[model samples]
Target: MFVFTPTPGTTWNLTVDNFTQALHRREGDEAYIHTHADAEGSYGPRDEHDWWFAFSATGESWAGTGSPAAGDHEGVALDEATAGAAAEFAAWVLRELVPPGAGMEYNTRVGMESGLPDEVLTENTVTELDAVFRKHLKASSS
Candidate 1:
């Protein structure tokens, strides 16, 4: 599991293998890679993001409802760098959880508030997220 504050009022919590069993039960395949993030509360001059993704040996897919769907909200609150950090963490987690693997792909939507540009927000988010991912990666390897 991974958790970080992208903004003052918003926190993003993401998990990869935590739902493996649930995916198998719901989709009938253990080879699936699943990730989900839930952002609660409006925070720090920005909106919230809540999204999910599931990939089978078949192809890429997303989870949730609506025309755009909740998954479309994946990185709405993040800048590109922070979003990249989040995406990298998700991808790495999927790769770590599944072996004999193929490449991965994803689609994400971000919500931007604040006069600040995405590049700025992303850089800051990335700095923090990179540390978090590295910590989890080391622990998982051990």
Candidate 2:
């Protein structure tokens, strides 16, 4: 899984509420976002693309991705299905959250552990993530 966060001192004060409010899904679309049962954020098993998106309150930003609801299945793997789902999730995130021309330096990491300030890899706008989303989701009109 991968993660992102607004750099400290940035004016963007992310809250779990924004994620709940930015709920957008095409009509008849099975994709959705639901507040986690216990956590201070949201989670959903999007069956449409076998992907899921999450909001971590601690990080005040994007959480990593994995199919927690892939009930009774093998664990997270880097196969095509896993990769596709992750790509789709990332696309949805950038499309729904990352405002156009957002200049805040967003911290990022590539581990499953999110919301930690000590593991910051690069504290900058990770435009590469946006590009990757565009590449994978270009053919998807939804």
Candidate 3:
């Protein structure tokens, strides 16, 4: 799991899993991300790749949906202010590498510990995040 604070108010948390590493597959017409990577020393049983993207403000969490190419997950509800950013971020991720699919999972991690500072989303932060995303996307794709 990786946590990024691109802007002051917004935070993105990315989780990665291998296609076969998940204990259970996504059920009921849900869309999923897939990937493969080699096993690390301590982590056991690894596969190619799988990933999920999410954002949060205060205690509220939001996830991206591939369908309709927007934001909001099945369980979490986002407020008006953060909704657009969350949707934009999610949609960006989905469009970048995640192919279109149904039942997209968002807000997959809510209770997980955060390592980012508490701050409001700022334009500078968003810009920083964009650079980071592009770098990561480039590296991963290669």
Best by lDDT: 2
Question: Tens-digit lDDT track for model 2 on 1-142?
Answer: 3333333433223333344345333212432444344243344443322343343222233333332222332112222223234444444444555454432222222222333332222222235544543443332323
Candidate 1 RMSD to the correct structure: 14.2
Tell me model 1's lDDT, rounded to 2 decimals. 0.33
Q: Residue-wise lDDT of candidate 1 within 23-94, one digit each (tens)?
A: 455567434341322354332222223333343321334332111123323222112333334554444333
**Per-model RMSD to reference:** 14.2, 12.9, 15.2
Query: Candidate 2, TM-score vs. the true structure?
Result: 0.34
Worst 10 contiguous positions by lDDT, candidate 2: 72-81
lDDT of the candidates, in the order given: 0.33, 0.34, 0.31
**Candidates ranked, most accurate by TM-score first:** 2, 1, 3
Could you tell me every candidate's TM-score relative to the true structure?
Answer: 0.21, 0.34, 0.21
Report the lDDT tens digits of candidate 3 across residue range 59-136.
544442211112221112222324335444434443333332322233212212322222222222445544543443
Which pairs clash (backbone N, Cα, C closer than 3 Å) in model 1?
Answer: 9-43, 75-110, 76-110, 76-111, 82-122
Error of 3 at 41 (Å): 19
- Model 2 misplacement above 4 A: 7-12, 24-81, 103-142
Error of 2 at 133 (Å): 9.4
Clashing pairs in 2: none
Off by more than 4 A, model 3 = 1-81, 100-103, 108-142
